[model samples]
Target: MQLIIMRHGEAGRHSLDHERELTEVGRKQAANVAEKIAQSDSKPSVIWCSPYIRARQTAAIVGDILGVPVKEKSFITPDDDPGRCLDALLENKESPLMLVSHMPLVGSLTTLLSDGHRNGMPFMTAQAVVLDMPVVGPDCATLKTQFLP
Candidate 1:
């Protein structure tokens, strides 16, 4: 199984967190990243995203290219622990899964798998981290590819 964790693109300043949509540059970034994601030949079986508009919008971009449905996974939010997030992914029998979420959570979760340190947390807007592993625990999803948008 493969897990593709992507952070939402840049949003407007002072906008409502749930209502924030992607900016013009963010849209382009998502498109570029989507292009790269499509090259995988193995698209996500489901595009899981935060209910937040920014994340949903980001997922929609790649979903357009991958032809995957965008389902809001509330556990991808900032305060949500990655355990629930990983559980949701594990429950899916799909080959590749795309998760669109926030910054610290994405970075922290990645660290929980790749390394023990969170000092190098860096998930840029529209950037994605692709992991290859068994459909098991969070530790199983080792970092495979990091895509910058």
Candidate 2:
């Protein structure tokens, strides 16, 4: 299975964190990343995105460009457990899955999947990493490369 992990674009500060929308620069960043994905040969079969506004917006752009459906998964939220997210993804049979999510979760999940440790990687906003995994488990995946927008 191929997994694509992406951190949502830059977002503006707001009293309600979950409702905070992406800024102009964020939108551009999302568009740039989407364009890059559209041109890539490894297109996602489906996209799983956090319900957060910024992530949802980012997923929308990518979904449009790739012509793939996006599903909102609460498990991908910033504060959610990476293990649980992995379990959920493992249940799915789709290959080349894309996940558009937030900071700590994105970084944590990447490390957990690629290196079997948390905090082994740092993910910037709008950054993406691809992993090739034979099975869903800690350290079972190989880092294929990364995309930055």
Candidate 3:
């Protein structure tokens, strides 16, 4: 399985975190990353994103560029357990999947899958990490590349 874990684009500050939306620059950043992915061989077959507005917007940009379907997932929000998210991913059979989410979860999930621990590498807004996994489990994936926008 090829997994793309992405941080949502930069978002405007809001009193309610879930209601926060992307900034204008965030849209461009997402578009830049999407264009790059669309040109690559590892384009996702489907996009699963956090229900937060920022993540949904970011996922939409990439999905439109890659001509893939986008689905909102409640479990991918910031602070959600990476292990549970991984379990949800395992239940889905989509290969070459892209997950658009927030900072801590994306980083934590990436590390959990690739390094088998939550000592995560930090991710910038609109950054993406690609991993190739023979099986989706702890320490089973190899880092393929990273895309920065």
TM-scores vs. true structure, each candidate: 0.90, 0.96, 0.98
What is the lDDT for 143 in model 1? 80
Error of 3 at 109 (Å): 0.4
Task: Please identify which of the two predictions, 2 or 3, would achieve the higher TM-score against the true structure.
Answer: 3
The Cα error of candidate 3 at residue 29, in Å, is 0.5
| lDDT, each prediction | 0.80, 0.89, 0.93
lDDT of 2: 0.89
What is the C-alpha local distance difference test score of candidate 3?
Answer: 0.93
Query: Which tens-of-lDDT digit does each residue in 1-149 have in candidate 3?
Result: 99999999999996599999999999999999999888888899999999999999999998988999999999999999999988987887998999999979998999999999998889999999899999889889999998999
Question: Which residue runs does candidate 1 get wrong by more than 4 Å?
Answer: 116-120
Q: What does candidate 3 score on TM?
A: 0.98
lDDT of 3 at 44: 94
Give the candidates in order of TM-score, highest first: 3, 2, 1
Largest TM-score belongs to which candidate?
3
Q: How many backbone clashes does candidate 1 have?
A: 0
Checking candidate 1 for backbone clashes, the offending pairs are: none
Q: In angstroms, give how far residue 85 of model 2 lies from its true place.
A: 0.4
